[model samples]
Target: MSALLQQRSTGAARDDARLRDRLVFGDETAFIDLYERFSSLVYTIAARVTRDRRAAEDVTQEVFLAVWQRPLAFDPAKGSLRGWVAMMAHRRAVDLVRREEAHRRTTLDGRLHAEPLGHGDPVGDQVSDADAAERLGTALRALPEHLSRAVTLAYLEGRTYREVAVELGVPEGTAKSRLREGLRRLAVALQSIHAQDGEGP
Candidate 1:
């Protein structure tokens, strides 16, 4: 049974490698095969993480699209294609959650600032969002300088990773790495703050 399991694993790895090669060669059928094999698993993981069917669907599509666009990004020597796809889905879902929370906090802060202060403790209502936004800003500032700059350009300024790389005079991969690390640190900082306030991050 152990030998049979090992054989099956070896066969699966070869299949994954062949599919990856076809994908790298721009074969449409290979893309279809990959999606057919992994899309459900990706969507299930995304839904589990994001807890929104629509967002899960979006993340699923985005993950497959990324695979189609960058097939060589996956290294068969490092891991199985299924595991890599699953990890991407989870990472993207978490990033989506973080972005949504940041936008909500930002929007709440904007509305607080925009609304006229007259009735029903507008000032009191502003306090929570104001504090959250302030904490977010402070957290961003606390990131390493390169990471903070990459994140600011890519996210806050709405620049693409390529644009951020060009603007910062760094390679695109380096820019992406910086932005990812920056967001991760920012998420940790904000989660800590939210936990302190008895809120979910």
Candidate 2:
């Protein structure tokens, strides 16, 4: 048993050194090798912990993505690559489950506690809604270029961050960062925008 353990350790150490070297040099092949070695294990960990196939897949992708983007984060002196990867998968999986739970609770609470909308005269309300939407569109156009483009791609075009990255010719991480920053700026822009007839949002 001890012999087998030592053999496994020796193999993992070799992989750690070789892959670490290639990864630091930005080698796609090394990324592929690392993914091939550990992705299934990561997926299984995520799936078991999250109990959602889609979420597990997302978590697995993110785990590998972090490794690819930050190769130096793994230190051979501190731990084996396999252990680091496993722990990352576990932590990310748990985080995903917690976020899912929080989203569920927020959604449930919103449905339970939301103020009921009064529909006084349906036809009049529809006309008013159309007018409000027109004003909102004008306000949206008044935003700065980056904020406008981000908001348009994400909200208007219904693009996810991945799709937004492709559409905007930016990295996926950059796309998300832009969207988050844009949303914050949009709130402030909306307050200042007085469209056509000059009504505050």
Candidate 3:
């Protein structure tokens, strides 16, 4: 039984080699097989970087689509097919992280400036926080639909302003302005709520 298992392993390796050769030659079936073999691995790496399951799935799909679109670019002499795919996955994941960080930095700068409330006022602090959140939500909902979407995409999803602009069919500057305006409105609304609650803003 051990000998039989060894033979099967050797056969699978040979089949994988053939499939890789076919991939280099631009065979669709080989590409599909390669995707099937590596999609989960790609997704796992993407998940580690993006820290979101859905984004990981998106990255995985994009990586495979890229592979399919540029099959001719894969140089077998330079690296194994798995290694090449892994590199693509890593690149996509890094891109996601960079885009997310840029969005956070762009939109949340003002909010982060608010000093934390003093200690020994947990109940007041919690109430103030809840009121601020509610007012911000109301202000966000009142924004024009496009501007609201831009704000949500940039701040909530942590998408880059450029990516939000692309998704919304707006200019990059428009995306930035929408985010800036939305954040200003949210900040004002939160301040009003705090003032009403006698929190002194």
What RMSD value applies to candidate 2?
Answer: 20.7
> How accurate locally is residue 168 in candidate 2, as Cα lDDT from 0 to 100?
76
Model 1 stretches with alpha carbons more than 4 Å out: 102-201
- The candidate that wins on lDDT is 1
lDDT of 2 by residue, 1-201 (tens): 356555655666776978988998999999999887787778766664565567778989999999888988998878678779988998887666556654422221111101221353211112223444454555555656665676555542334678778877889998898888877766555534423223221
Answer with 1 or 2, whichever has the higher TM-score.
1
Q: Cα lDDT for residue 15, model 1?
A: 83
lDDT of each: 0.70, 0.64, 0.64
The deviation in Å at residue 29 for candidate 2 is: 0.8
State which candidate has the highest TM-score.
Answer: 1
- Give lDDT tens digits, candidate 1, residues 157-196: 4356897889889999998898889889987887567555
For candidate 3, lDDT tens digit of each residue in 162-194?
988887788999889988987777767654564
Q: How accurate locally is residue 43 in candidate 1, as Cα lDDT from 0 to 100?
A: 76
lDDT of 3 at 16: 50
What are the clashing pairs of model 3?
none
Weakest 10 consecutive residues of candidate 3 by summed lDDT: 108-117
Which residue runs of candidate 2 sit more than 4 Å off their true CA positions?
Answer: 1-8, 102-201
